[model samples]
Target: MNWSGWSIDRVLILFVSLAYLVIGIQVTMFHYRQNFTHKAMWIPVISSPIFLIAGLILTWYNAPWVHTMFMAFMWFGALAGLIGFYFHFRGVGIRVGGWAMRNFLIGPPVALPLMFSALSVLGLIAIYWKVR
Candidate 1:
């Protein structure tokens, strides 16, 4: 209701946030359903979707606080991704490759979380600009 001066910037940032949420959900669900063996690591996989959902909810209402909320979610997601990557590379031994090489057995690992981190950082910058 308080959408005072909605502009392209706001619209774009909001769109990016929405895209982030959707992509995150898709990745999380696909990973969960595919890998039933890694029960312990599922927490990080599962928590991301919830964060994205919260980000979507807060962003939808055009709330001023959305920036801070998103900051929290994105940062958490980023941290989780970093930790996941470390463990995967160090201990999990999951194969990594380009998108073209991806198959049923090996999904994109490093890229997804890295993408999340990069996009979230972009989202944060966009939020800052919007607030400024």
Candidate 2:
């Protein structure tokens, strides 16, 4: 289906991109609060489902680059969630160690959103590029 030269695949990509963007915003806001310290949170409540749905959409559409990007984004989100869990349990004497752990703990809030934004820009470019 085409909507004024926009194909359904492009539309789906746009939707997935927007979903990630919104999720990124929510997670970043939560991080800014510095308040995930006490809750037994295993995942980012907002981003997990949003990204899950976006992943499903990308898979269904079979868009190669977008789907790969979504998988990478999900991996990052999961790693970030794991770091949060480790931090939460650390207060009770639990410990975790890995070289990447430090990066995960410090980077997700900024990196995740930028990834989503980049995906959005790519989708927009795809939507507008001349279909030869």
Candidate 3:
């Protein structure tokens, strides 16, 4: 979709939905295996909100004031995911070396930089569109 003219509400909804999907996957993994170390599980839990914050800041930097509001809403949703992650991790001890950790180790090296770059590009586009 053309995110430039998209309302903040829509963007927030979309971001939240994505966050939910990620959290849901994590929960499902936990349910199926029931054997993740707290440390492994907490990586995504902690980093997810940080990712949202980064996205929000990028949005604010690039988009209009109205869009910034939506970014805030998205951030809130991400915060909820963080809380859920915290609770899940609290109950479950560290699983040490496992799928989660393996992914964690690999994800940042690959996915994170790509995600940041994509957000950066999106922010630039938002800014360009706003200025135009």
**How much is the lDDT of residue 97 in candidate 3?**
47
| lDDT digits (tens) for residues 28-131 of candidate 2 | 56655766554533245555566656655663575777666665665566465456545543433332443356645653333443544454455445444565
Clashing pairs in 1: none
> Which RMSD values do the candidates have, in order?
4.9, 11.5, 9.5
- Best-fitting candidate, scored by lDDT: 1
Error of 1 at 54 (Å): 3.3
Residue 30 lDDT in model 2?
66
The residue ranges of model 1 lying beyond 4 angstroms of the native Cα positions read 1-5, 33-36, 91-108, 130-132
Model 1: per-residue lDDT, tens digit, 13-113?
67656766676676667566667455636755566566656556655666767657766776776676676566444432444442234432364355565
TM-score of each candidate structure, all chains considered together: 0.61, 0.36, 0.30
lDDT of 1: 0.60
Highest-TM-score candidate: 1
Off by over 4 Å in 2: 1-43, 94-132
Residue 86, candidate 2: Cα error in Å is: 1.9
Ranking by lDDT: 1, 2, 3
